[model samples]
Target chain A: MGSPAGTGTGTGLINGMMGRNNIFWHECAVGRGDRQRLLKQKGCVVWITGLSGSGKSTLACTLDHELHSRGKLTYVLDGDNLRHGLNRDLGFSAHDRTENIRRVGEVAKLFADAGLICIASLISPYRRDRDSCRAILPDASFIEVFLNMPLEVCESRDPKGLYKLARAGKIKGFTGIDDPYEPPLNCEIEIKQEEGACPSPSAMAGQVVSYLEEKGFLED
Target chain B: MGSPAGTGTGTGLINGMMGRNNIFWHECAVGRGDRQRLLKQKGCVVWITGLSGSGKSTLACTLDHELHSRGKLTYVLDGDNLRHGLNRDLGFSAHDRTENIRRVGEVAKLFADAGLICIASLISPYRRDRDSCRAILPDASFIEVFLNMPLEVCESRDPKGLYKLARAGKIKGFTGIDDPYEPPLNCEIEIKQEEGACPSPSAMAGQVVSYLEEKGFLED
Candidate 1:
């Protein structure tokens, strides 16, 4: 391929350069700051982790509604919902579960980079998996909210009757039954029952909203 | 798991219900329409495809800048850049390449669902891979922009020096070299050399911007 004449026109076009290992990182003029300015809100990831039936999805939807009503843009990345699409290839095996969390973390980072509040709701029972997700986000941008409901409470609630299945040996490896759930050691927000009465969905959502507002995530 | 008193307390908390297949679909009040209204723009995927040296990334960045200047949000998902992050486990095998494209398409769909204009720049030489991406987006939102630069022109440019390596048999299965690059038959926009000269980045970006403007993608 010693075509000299054709090479002359080709050299005049490319603007992006090769980084280490032959990878090209295109430098864009419009960046995260520009996008956040346009949206009038700082981009961040709100990670909600809990056992099954612990209100992770409910709180995520509630928080999303609260933010949207306040003129803020938000997207909820529900773990179960994503199983129908992005993470459908993944299964319940340990390796597959870690890969699912890794993929979800990367997607959430992209959404945050695009200048939106990303709410990720998952029964991420393992602490290391949830920590890895936190490590990927920007500093102070990964707000970890723990649904600290007792296993007894969650099992009693049994929204999907999953506890019954797990207890009856119909569903093995279900969190809080055969599977262990390592609670967050230092989460940003924690919602738990008070006097044995669980908080309403709106009340739980309001608590998270106040935290976002106080942290200046609601403003550019 | 059959404790009646615990079930009574649990029934008071859950706000979401089970859907078909026992999957819980958390109903969020904040939908895509609400997000678009907040951003004042419609979400869409602008897929840019061509040979390695066809200036796909350049056009994507230019278009991103142009759209951001007009107060619209945009994100560019460069294929090479993604290799270092979300798709690092993948290699150059045909199966891996297809999986790579699939994951990127899924991420692009998520970005569009988050109400941002997503620009995806890649060599994506296969027609089937591109069409699969098209099937995921909403109607008229997957704008495939073909960079139809001649192979001679791209080989001449060799921006990343990949062509030179490929010619020397150092790099195997390089697109437009050993691997075939199937051009799009029904692309939404085609950018090619004009009068034996390439269009300036702004000019190329303007064409796509004009199409987006006309398609009501720039507004809610």
Candidate 2:
């Protein structure tokens, strides 16, 4: 007999069952193309990675506003909001940090598959974890938008005073403080200050929307 | 000074941070109504619950296809597909099952918020877990569809022979065999066999589509 689907023999049985049904299940299922067609736009992940307080969330919200105003479906998976729900069980240990990025990456992939432009705003200092997220989506669909705002600029903004807390040693392992921020070696898009000043939120979102348009993500 | 957003102090800080941002997040963000207007349909979760091998996946696929053909964006959160990625870390323990349902419920809420009709197919055996899932969504948006096919019929179909493995004790704590399945006491929809015969997949999907239409989910 064929391997029983979800025999629940344990974790040992998961591989066999999932592998058996992967191809057949995908064949019978409604596909990403179908969902994209319905939405009239290609689903993609706009992963905004930078140090904490680096305008990642601002860019995400601005991008969400820009896209939604243009009648596109977009959802933001902000790291802060997620900590209250899906990632609540996780802590900020090295292992949990990786797991946190992994779970967020996976969820963003699902949102992309569902035909929404998913904006993921996270510090995501580790390059390996970000690359792993890129590996899950189709080529060009995982648009890694690096917010190249300087740590000095972010610290000065300190819109929520996180930098001050980190400076005071009240918070530890904070990216750009104790933790290292690894810049992406080859991201699809990069947003940085034009001069000594950060670009307006609309201008920042315009850059991404333009990239999405050029890459054919704004259309089915 | 305002509470530092995501100070990384630990889990202790999550509550305070999220509470501060909850109202502001919803206010500045693109609301669900905008997404629904963009998609020309209201977002909602169609959660299908039943025993294993009870055509839950079949109905989910059928509904996905049916909705897609009519130009509605829909996504299925099948228990098996989810187990491979989002819930891979979870096992078959009782606690794991509850966690599984919780995570799926949260993800489904995200999908609905993205303005897609999300169909969640799972052999969720506990009433409390399913009720908790319902509680997380807006009232009347979480439509619980109970597939009331008899366990005998499901065992007879044995599409993947899961019931056979369960019966032979190869899979312990299998729902409707070693374990129990607490059917929904107040599901929004119920599909049961007639004249000792199960309904066709299209018929089952049609029932759900009709309900969605009547409930004004098919249009903004």
Q: Please report the candidate that would top DockQ against the real structure.
A: 1
Q: What is the model-wide C-alpha lDDT for candidate 1?
A: 0.83
TM-score of each: 0.90, 0.90
In model 1, the runs with Cα more than 4 Å from the true position are A1-21, B1-22
Q: Residue B126, candidate 1: how far off, in angstroms? A: 0.7
Cα deviation of B79, candidate 2, in Å = 0.7
Model 2, runs deviating above 4 Å: A1-14, A17-28, B1-14, B17-28
Q: Which pairs clash in the backbone of model 1? A: A157-B10
Query: Per-residue lDDT for A24-46 in model 2, tens only?
Result: 13223677887787778999999
Residue-level lDDT tens digits of model 1 in B1-220: 0111232322232333222234445556677778888888998999999999898988998999999999888899988767756886787889988888988888888888878899999899999999999987878889999999999988898887889878888778889999999999999999998999999999999999999999899999
The worst-scoring run of ten residues by lDDT in candidate 2 chain A lies at A18-27
DockQ measured for candidate 1: 0.38
lDDT tens per residue, model 2, B1-220: 0113554331233334322331112123677788888889999999999987788888998998999899898888877777777877888889988999999998898888778899999888999999998987886999999999998988998776677877776777888998999989989999999898899999999999999999999999
